[model samples]
Target chain A: MAFAEFDLIDTYFSQRMEQRDDVELGIGDDGAVVTVDAGNQLVVVTDTMVAGVHFDQDTPARAIGHKVVAVNLSDLAAMGAEPTWISLALTLPSIDQDWLQGFTHGLREICEYYGCQLIGGDTTQGPLAVTVTAHGVLPHGSAIKRTGAKPGDWLYVTGTLGDAGLALAARQRRQQVSDAHYRRITDRLYFPSPRVALGQSLRGVASSAIDVSDGLLADLRHILKGSRVGAKISLDELPLSLALTETLTQDQALAYALTSGDDYELCFTVPESQRGVFDTLVAHTASKPVCIGRITNEAEALQLTLQGEPWQLPETNTGYEHFASPIEPSV
Target chain B: MAFAEFDLIDTYFSQRMEQRDDVELGIGDDGAVVTVDAGNQLVVVTDTMVAGVHFDQDTPARAIGHKVVAVNLSDLAAMGAEPTWISLALTLPSIDQDWLQGFTHGLREICEYYGCQLIGGDTTQGPLAVTVTAHGVLPHGSAIKRTGAKPGDWLYVTGTLGDAGLALAARQRRQQVSDAHYRRITDRLYFPSPRVALGQSLRGVASSAIDVSDGLLADLRHILKGSRVGAKISLDELPLSLALTETLTQDQALAYALTSGDDYELCFTVPESQRGVFDTLVAHTASKPVCIGRITNEAEALQLTLQGEPWQLPETNTGYEHFASPIEPSV
Candidate 1:
């Protein structure tokens, strides 16, 4: 007989989300059992990826699984929560054993690395889609919120930005570029690393922080809005890959860097007085966070300066949205 | 301008999942916040409903939303936990203004009834699908499990069965039945009252329990498999509705009660002495649970008897398996 949905779940989706001390019971029951620290609070977020929307039909199964799980983990990182468990709702048009095996392997790889367990979830037959809800725990009153920034808090971002956007733009054939540029851009697009440890390290050090999910300009503005602060972004300070610079003009590259999203990097604010210690803290990690701008008390307006000359970018709000449009419509 | 996904989120989904004391910060940022309660463990579960697979495409949007959330909440009820919050991931083919309004209204009605705040969720464009991830808290050592039943425990089910299965059978024909029968069966199918409070009350009382999303026979077998026990269900004692028995013969109705699935009732095992208390508890609630069988210390087998005459109800494993045969295919 062909594989039934029952067999598919038993064969693959039945494995534990992960094995953690907090998880009293894993998969195979009505729900999952988890023990949170005595004074810790739980952190939760949900994301849905629909085929033909978030991902095309032909995207590698491994990449789709990795991206879905990684994106949610990135949310927990922003909240300074230690990952604990995840529940997955998989909707498939049909039972594809090979696709499921690859998906599970990638999921297992990430869950094991994050010390989170697979809790309880359901699988059903429908149009291909994957919805993941990841849960984590944070010490009571210890989480970093977006509204904690103050004037004079120096802004920093971990690693690069525009690369993912450029990578996406190049893949869409928006404009022609050299093979080297195309390769670098697409690679970034396919595998944007989440800055988990860096976020955890910024627990008390960074006054305000949020993940760079939307392009830097829009996402950073969230911190500014939440903290009732404004910021001046030094366009010249944006980090660019050599290949990216070779493919597009400096201004064009800067546009993608400022506005293209999907980078899962941390854009945070640390007090200027703590700058010396912050620099020392970064020495322990290979992924160095770069200083980009400073938070200000001025009314909410984001200014960009290039070599002391002012530049204006489009005001269109971007990044992922979940209402009229599905998420990652162009992914 | 098109209804940008972000604007739609801001106008609707942003606050669909609410923030509570347990939730540090609500939506509109990188992620949401939920603090773990001290000494209480968190139970997580998710269920997805596709428009045509789980529910008819023409099903009322309000009821559809309510049922999707209720079905997931049923998982928590099976675990005997008090649901506190939920996140929804909805994938839609397109934006229908009235549908959105009705969907949210239904979602909010049930969420308020259960005291579960909507925390955060995502929306995507795809076939009509809705997934809900619900979280609940139980005392550290008190979460009821599905593997604790002993052979000598009594087999019991909460409320009536077969009504939902029959309702679907009728709905497929779109034939109108008596108002009373319609009220009774439609409630069974659409407004399944999950035994959350009842399940919680049985925490220390029930040996093992599972919500009857599948048929009672199929669900009870889950307990049997997990606890390594067998069961003898007294078919005559099964709870059936007058409306159900009117159109179908007693045997056919009994078979539907035993194997047609989708009742969303609770089937469980408890010591014989707890029967009086269980009955007493049901007398106080609108929904009444019924005792139908006894557990046996044998290898996995399910036997049904009528009027003291033993009959073999060989297991067909008739719970609605995702992607099983074409029978319970995704809506």
Candidate 2:
């Protein structure tokens, strides 16, 4: 059977996700009409994933769908906004019914979990790729920016890191792991949980915030540059998953935790006055927020310490550059 | 020199567009935060264009950038919304300086003309493609929908049609045209004008509205199906450009006008009771609205007439299908 564009959308996308009262018009219109509450502001973020560049052919279609939404949602989480709606622009080399089924299922699963509705989008024939533009909402003055940190702030991060990097290394045959550990590590790489609730909880508490998509050191640099402050982090304070610690040495695990990307955990800063309140509030959350360092008055300076001695960064301190040579799965 | 993602965005996009008060945070952030007035609703639209599918290698980069923004704005125009902000998710095979210069120049030109600002977006390395999600705003209850047409509503279309189809045919060597006319028609295809002002003026007047991106007959069918009302259109009444009329026979021109896509004009319906007011309101507009049809009580039936006699549709009545085999240049 030939599936035309409209039929494909009707079969897989329309009427599949939950509808919200704010969506006056959803699919099947030239554009969608939605309302933002009286005192709320709209937050918009977009992310794109390509076939060979972002994922390998062996990656499941469901994982691709989930990752595209997850990455965009992670950005929203960084902004301390609640995900509300998403528009997907999907491109495919050909029509594959099974792939479409799995992709839509994954998309629906995450959107429903986040209470976001699939508003509308475009479907085209091209290289396999998907671009998701997510819409979020928050109170008018509650947005947490990267430029809000100050000297004497306490730096923190949610959840552990380095598992995703170790997972990719295993998948590429650079490392070996047992089946059970491999499953745990790969699950971290595939289905990253965006810290949506934690981000919201830190809206009034965090002095500055950013999602760790490009390694802990690299992402922390953004906060330092934006806020014009410095940070001193202890490598021993870096959080690591059991899968990563068991598979690699302490030094190797620290390297991955500091330089590897694809960890969707939130890296944030809290002022000294609010540290106690932040710790108390985070104690009840699912992910235990870990304090890693403190902010300094030195502008754009990042100091690292291992044990009790000062440490040096690798010769190449760059993070994941999108156009850098020898493409690897970064996001 | 390596053009990293951050460098590319900062050099080309960050400082180019106009800054607006409504945008609390623009580029360089995880997400953009924008305000919507208390009495207004948001209109969102997304469209994607791919290389080899939307345009050939001979197409100019400037045209690609302009067309992508124009198509999304056209959808907003159909919804009777004022264009405000846009987010772009661009994927490129490689970094070409000249292409980026021309593309950003074109994008900035059109955006400045429409008073729309570029907020934030994603850039990735992949096959060449661009997805633009545009946001617009309108009064809370003034959005013109596709399901609001009623019996005795007069259908009207803005500007002319079929020139873009003829332009494509000429470019493909399937048709011949004079050098002067070729530029005129190709300009129609490349730099389509989204009827932003006219669409805004149509608020509360046009019962239903849609943009003509998938040919006239195919797009009109959407309104007919959604409104559950039939239409009677006169083929001879379809507005044709001078270039199209002089290049092809009347029958061929009418056929192109009815069946070709990428016109980017507005098709709307006004009730008979408000016809006088609509005519007076449209008389002061740039694109003179032309009456070509009237709504009927018969459900989902479209009757066509040429001169005074009943007309029949061609065997293949479908519009541009995104996943259809034998890829063609489409927006």
Candidate 3:
């Protein structure tokens, strides 16, 4: 409590980031002034994480900071925008120097990688919570939207799924895993990588896109509801991590892939005509884009199949709804 | 707790605001896409208010909602930007139908009045807090900054000061006031009007500008430090509302005017050359712009005088620092 707001910002945030030319005025101002490229439109996204709700005390402060920024940037990536600037409103119950150091370190690492500038924000004393508003820009008319999916579009997801869920299960003692596998899987939960480059490459190639934060089915529902289309996905086609597959049964792994959240991977649709182009674009990237389903004409209907046989979802079909229930540390 | 996040947004926020043309995609998207005018730059500011820290149980939910937006808009006003869009991150302990209704109603009223669109935000379950990030637009190179003041510039303020401070004093039982006076003063504390038009008008004329949210002298110190200039102000010229003057002794009112905060009025400086333009522009406005003092050659020094005699500031020179101490409801 002895740390003044100005000193806290100066010590932790102001000098930590590199300056950008687009930011006319950065921190230490009433409001930040930044220029958007002439031919680009601004994409804005905001996400908030509360200590006990979005995360728990067992979670590292560094991971908490990284996850907060990653979540917001994931939304920007879903819109196929290049990250540019971020403003963070951080509230803390008390100031712990070690916690502050770790948190800012995680924040700076992601920001440096994405080439985004920390413009300005507010810091207050209260229960721990972080609200980040990220700003990005894309060429005018190039933003991929949830409403743009077509009935004949093919569904694709970048990277593997269910690793975060598997990590959560192991941590909560619902499942046991080898030490090495636990480390790798827990990293997936703590340090989700926003598909920035993949999203940028998907702009014209993909018809519609969204990030897998609210589980694959729930997020796909958004695309279907907006585009007024249906989807039929193959369970066998789901990309699963080695750790997830090794730790859980086939059904449980598939269930986690289908219903659990916080993957932060890109789920998108590509028209059949552009399938080759999409394949060529993602061919060199580290993310393995896998085709899992196809859009259908039936509005708002989702069909699941396993090796050509009909399949059904688990009873807990509801995805992450903030106010519906408390979010346990394990997803 | 039964209300889903989507329902919470749709029922209270989605349909309430008028659609804006510049907002290409609004709520119900992974991210909101907005267009900044070709020749304009973006001004961004974020502010967070915590329940017990920023307000108390007695504070109305409507006032909380209004003040959050007002505070951010006040920052944009300081930058001489035209308010455009807002994103809110709201955390609540639990669902209260009446509180939500009043809060959203207040939010809608302010956004409608300011011509700002609510693009998107996150609603979560946690301790009660609200963080609002406001976006605005200004013509290229037109932003007025605190670093622009020069020695010999004249200092001026928009409207009266010390009203909010007096209201806080009355509410905390530190001062006594008539019922009518209390109502008038507390209204100042609850629903502060950001001087948007006045700020826009001063874009070219004012050398430096800042919103007085941390008392007059503390905010003025920012201008002085940034601009590397000093200032000499007349205590007799400090404008006090009739409600403030009627409730406290002259010295007590001056102390509040100098040290108390949450006024949201603009304190700015104008070089002698542009003084005529500033006076002429503000002549027709409701806010009576008053000249308080002049900038001095000494760097980072502030001098006070009353009727041409040197004066001393109150012992409590330190201003509001969020983490330095708790923000009582009255403040």
Candidate 4:
């Protein structure tokens, strides 16, 4: 017999969620009740991941669970908010107890690490999908926004880029790589670390910020659009992992770095006046921020250069488009 | 050529959301930023409706849209919270512009009516489903909970019961219902007006509260379990609409009222001492509640009575079980 929805929730979800003082009511209630701090504003975001689209149908439950929460948390990181609570709406084609146990274990692990409590959610029968709505809090008027960047702001990205994209390419059989490179790239794809702490530390330092999800170029376009500015990016300055450079040709690696999506790193802009403070702040952080470009007032187009020579974007070098692309398994 | 997720959101959701001052930031940002009043706690709930499961595949898109938001709003009503914002995670097979227009039209109409702004959400390509998470606010510590019921509390239900169940039976061709009865029953299923105002007024009066999504008997059992009490229900006292009573035999209607689900009505308890206050409050409300039972200290088993005689529940008379039961589209 299939597991009943009520019993499954009691067994897998309700007890697994850690308790918090701010949660007056949690799972099992009609709705969860939580209080926001008086001087803070609540930041809410929702993202849905579909099986066979966001991940392979055979992907491990643990990895799927971790990735869903991580991606939504990345949104909070972009806003420079501290995640306080999350709610998940999970739909499954059938009841697989073993899969559920592994999934919840992974979800709980990450949630506990971040001190974010799962307050409530829903479980239903359908094609497998997970929709996580994360809630975070930031001090009033202190949130980093894409609209805050000025023309002279310096663009910086945390950690390396193109690793996840390269991993996806290998998984899709579009590129060949050694076993070592495959492992490293897949690890980056399956277990991305949301730059929550880095974003939090950059609250007052970064002029504008966004998480790199739909590739460097696409997400940067969001920042540019919101701030009503353009940018000039140095192709050679784009961060690349050792595996990425070693496994693929320079041109291929550059394309993946620019257009391959699913990287959860923070791409932020720091105005010239805040550069000194930002540099100092990054020194104490876990990941060093790399300056890759500069914001510009030339709103007509974004300028790309490689070794001080103008470069034209290849026609095929485009970021993931939700409508145009098939449900690619890599992510 | 299909509509991109970006353009679809811009056309259907972003501009249509009513502006709110408390929403410092809205859709299109990394996350929505909202301010809560100092004395209020936020109530959040998420519910997912899958095609061919929550509703028939042929069900109109507008009806599906309306029901998704309505069902989530009912949770807030049960907690006496005033809905302020809603985020929708909509997964679809492909872009159908006509369907989308009707669906968003239905969503916008309700949000505008309730003054709940569409804050932020996700749109992904996948199987047809909608996961809506609603957020509301209430005075701190004033929300009604199922655990508040105690021995000697009277049970009351808002509106009628069994209409949706009967409608579902008719749709499946297991029961025959006249066209007039069909129209009324389907309407009840599609558009349930959440008792937000009544719930707000009954905040201090209700000892325990829950929305009747899984039939009267099953949902009331939740209250009994939470409060560590049992209940004695009078079958004759159940409030049934004319259509239900006229369409089904007496025993059939009784069984439906007790076990059939998706009523979206509130069932609550009021302590004996607050009877006078509750009665007075209900008199001024739009839907007069029906007193159907009383909470008892018999914690082991619930007692059922029909016309003052003991009644035994049939072994098969159980409420909807999400995993085990077939998708009965009338939800």
lDDT of 2 at B99: 92
Report how far off residue B35 is in candidate 4 (Å).
0.7
lDDT of 4 by residue, B261-303 (tens): 8899999999999999988888877789999999999873688
Candidate 2 has a DockQ of 0.74
Give the per-residue lDDT digits (tens) of candidate 1, residues B1-331.
2445556667776664433666666666556777766778888888998877888766788888788888878889989999988888888777888998888888888887888888778777778899999988888878888899887888888788888888887776644456689778977788777788987888878888898886777777778888999998888889988877887767777877888767888888888777777667668776767778889999688887899888654455465666753334433
- The better-scoring model by TM-score among 1 and 4 is 4
lDDT of 1 by residue, A1-331 (tens): 3345445667886665456776788877888888888777778888887887766765678777777888888888887777778998998878777898878887877888878777768888777889999987777777778899998899888887778777666666676778877776666666556677777777778888888776787778788888999998787887777766877787777777777777878888999888888899898798798887878789577788999899766445455444434234432
Whole-structure CA lDDT of model 1: 0.78
Best first by DockQ, ranked: 3, 4, 2, 1
- Evaluated at residue A1, the lDDT of candidate 1 is 37
Candidate 1's C-alpha runs over 4 A off are A1-6, A15-17, A314-331, B13-20, B174-176, B273-283, B311-317, B325-331
> Where is model 3 more than 4 Å wrong at Cα?
A325-331, B325-331
**What lDDT, from 0 to 1, does candidate 2 have?**
0.88
* Candidate 3 local lDDT, B23-134, one digit each (tens): 9999998999999989999999999989878777787889988899999999999999999999999999888889999899888899999999999999988889999999
What TM-score does the A-chain of candidate 3 achieve? 0.97
